[model samples]
Target: MPPSRQPGFENTRSNEYWFCFSSPNVESHLIISISENHYLALAKGPLVEDHVLIVPVEHMPSTLSLSSEFEVELCQFQNSLQRYCKSQGKEVIFLEWVFIRATHANLQAIPIPSSKAVIVEKAFNLASQKMGFKFVSKNFDSISDGRKFLKTQADEESSLSYAEISGGIILLHHVEEKVRFLAQFGCEVGI
Candidate 1:
């Protein structure tokens, strides 16, 4: 049997009271609604003060389970957010952690200074090397390539779109199911 819902709450994702938009908790943190079914909220536990979380109205287990239509919507939002972040002189890193029991699909957008932005990829690559997997760089000669790579790679079970930003996209897959602890899944890697 599925878990029981709290009294008087309907459509709460994973029974998380905060997932209900009507709840004051959700209302207070909302930054913008991307579409009828998607919204961006100020992350409650942000890596940076302005870190934003792009979330779907309905609960999604993970990006692995998102529909093609939703995927397109996410892409459009990312592009729009990237441009806005760039104009503000801030570089944003979009990260998604696809795990087994994710209550909602929350894509994180974190901004840092321009100088740090230039070395963000290097940090990610170094972290991957420390973790023992050679980070694969997707062919990002064009924006379309990044889209294609994300669509193809993440479609596979338990895979990752590792990192996607204005710079490019790095894709990875988790082949070992038992290895579930993603040390820094939702946080920025250190310098």
Candidate 2:
């Protein structure tokens, strides 16, 4: 028999699959597009109403081995989505680029109030490091015509994040822990 179909991709004739990220209790607001190969899905998470997940079409064992193009495209799309959210007056918390051991690679864009950028960044950095991931900072605003470039990347990826999806719950919890840890350090987090 051919490979067993994933729940959402039951119809072989379809190129896109629309379904909830994980739990229906989360409101099922997020949407995802599964790749033709069924190896990846571009998911929009709903952690803060404006989250996005850039997932790989294939289930990679580790994120450290992803293609350079895939990584770049993921980040670029994330930046564009954040810009769009900002234009809509939505708050952006932080972006979560996650690599699950058993599934595809995913990049989640979480929206938080602008006032919480610094706090969220610091918390994410600390939490990511604690999780054995290296932290690198990229100046997204410094890129030339950044939004356009990112939009192009998004099209290439063919994915979007939405409200009520919790695809990146693990990373979200990590961020929450970091925020709590920062609060314990006497930092007032206003998100």
Candidate 3:
């Protein structure tokens, strides 16, 4: 079953509410929505444009504890967004993370050029440094160990597949670098 709706809320539009937040580092703007009891937003991060964050509306410590329904909704929303991006002629890069200390679970999606693999790699390295988390580069065969690493973190244990972590970081860095690149195109990132 879906989580109960928060009290004192009227059905304004389609079972969800969207709110836009002011972002300092992004000029394109950040628009957020509370839909189906989850937090959904569009953000223009540093490395890529049209970045989106999809999170649980209620405070949840980690992805490991998310209800099955929330997981389904998240996946459905992600797929729909990816389709939308594809229709726009941009490839969507999906990223998900369970930060031990953060109260909410997060998933980020960024649009990037198909040929920027090297730049994506560099961005991953930079994200590792900024977040103070070790970045491990590995292939599919080494994913089990990676899951173990996340499982041992102090605050909570959440498993992350190698593909998930690698792809997630790449998307993050791509968004982080978007603003600087946008300048060359004569567009300013307002926030």
Candidate 4:
């Protein structure tokens, strides 16, 4: 039998549903910046004020499956967002839900007050307990190191979700293909 279909992409092979980034007619105000491989845009139905998304220009399933050139540009956009948020007394937490057949890979950048940053890890830990999963935690000295670790931990065949927290720490949970997953898990945890 063929592999099981990912929930949202069974009948779709295009990025039309995620139109804010893919649409040529995207609202100028919703877009923050565009780069060679990605676009930083305000998210639709944001979970918090100033929530944004970093999406690839090309249709792809996961950032981990992309090239280093793509990773470099993505890191640049991430850094820019972090800087902007920091200037506003906030820090960013970047999240991604990688699946076997997602229509497009996008990173959700959520800004929280720097004062509340300490509680983020604790919240995720509690959430994991309630959600019946464990997050394998790791620390990195830079974005490249964190990204590299994630790349090695999962691939196109693996379903996982991760949060690139401020200060070079990342928490990743490998989602068993057989288990029911909350696609918005990272966002829910953040909220």
TM-score of each: 0.77, 0.42, 0.49, 0.88
Over 92-179, each residue of candidate 4 has an lDDT whose tens digit, in order, gives: 9999998875766789999999998888888988998998988888989988889998899876566899999987989999987789
Which residue pairs collide in model 1, if any?
Answer: none
lDDT of 3 at 22: 20
Q: Which numbered prediction scores highest in TM-score against the true structure?
A: 4
lDDT of 1 by residue, 72-169 (tens): 77767777777887888887887777654455577778887777887876777777777666666664764446656665655323545366655675
List per-prediction Cα lDDT, in the order shown. 0.63, 0.37, 0.44, 0.82
Worst ten in a row by lDDT for model 4: 1-10
Give the Cα-based TM-score of candidate 4 against the true structure.
0.88
Give per-residue CA lDDT, model 3, range 1-191, as digits (tens): 11222332222221232321222232223445557756667654435567777666555544435666776666577667667776777655555444332334555656665555336555555645664544455433332333344334423322332123224332121212112221111012111
Error of 3 at 39 (Å): 3.0
Best by lDDT: 4
Which 10 residues in a row give candidate 2 its minimum summed lDDT?
161-170
lDDT of 4 at 114: 95
Q: Which regions in candidate 1 have their CA more than 4 angstroms from the true location?
A: 1-13, 17-28, 141-144, 155-161, 173-175
Report, for all candidates in order, the number of backbone clashes: 0, 13, 16, 0
